[model samples]
Target: MPANFTIVTLGVADLDRSARFYRDLGWEQRGDQAEGITWFRTSGSWVGLYGYDALAEDAATEPVPADELPTYRGVTLALNLASEAAVDLAFARVQEVGGTIVKPAARTDWGGYSGYFADPDGHLWEIAHNPYWTVVDGRVDIGAT
Candidate 1:
């Protein structure tokens, strides 16, 4: 079977809060929204948010421990921009939309410009512009060799 990714879902404490955070980040919701879930369109795949307990129950698993709140250990939601200038622009837009900067945008040793931020629920996100990458028709095709 060929492998493909269709949706990226995040387990959130509050679906409406996560949805508002994404909306503040300029994402538009798609289709119908359930009581504890929200969906947004992205470049290649759709993004979704569902209440943490709800998601766990749906998967037939116990809810993760409350102490493990936010749950982002080494994971980051990354966005790739078309140009270095676009990187600056996107970072500014993120700030304007209620995201808190974890790191200022700067050139990296890997030859890219990037920065980090957190959503309202403290989920980490990275906005980056890699000189060696490209986005065509809103799809990110990695070229950083």
Candidate 2:
């Protein structure tokens, strides 16, 4: 089977805020954008942010209540960096951009360096640098052998 990921759409309580957050992180918008949706071109795949209600409606699911305080629910979006130094740099950017650090960057018992942060919507993001992994053209192979 072909291995590819074309897009990652994040359900955001406030699409504008989420889009601004990623834009602050240096992502470039691609094509035309709408009020309840914003699309950005990342290094490889497209990262998208959509209004929670819009996303839920599109999927034919109920939108999680915006004021209800959602939990991580074991979902984490990961950004794999090129090296330990890159990991630190990215995490630093997260903090500088007003993201709360959920975990400090450090060596893991699993033989990698990683950390976590929460975006404006409380969505968890894991930034990691696995020495056993390699990235080609900005896409990292998490299962490198």
Q: Weakest 10 consecutive residues, lDDT, candidate 1? A: 64-73
lDDT of 1 by residue, 1-145 (tens): 7678888777777677778878877887986666557789997788888777877888999975655665366789888888889889988887888878999899999999999998766678888888887877667888556
For model 2, residues 1-145, the per-residue Cα lDDT tens digits are 7788889888888777777788888779765557667898877888888877888899999876877855566788888888999899998888888888999899999999999999888888899988988877778776834
Q: What RMSD, rounded to one decimal, does every model reach? A: 2.3, 2.0
> Clashes in model 1: which pairs?
none
User: Which residue runs does candidate 2 get wrong by more than 4 Å?
Assistant: 1-3, 142-145
What lDDT, from 0 to 1, does candidate 2 have?
0.83
Best by TM-score: 2
Clashes by residue pair, model 2: none
Each prediction's whole-model lDDT (CA): 0.81, 0.83
Residue 39, candidate 1: Cα error in Å is 0.8
The positional error of residue 115 in candidate 1, measured at the CA in angstroms, is: 1.2
Maximum-lDDT candidate: 2
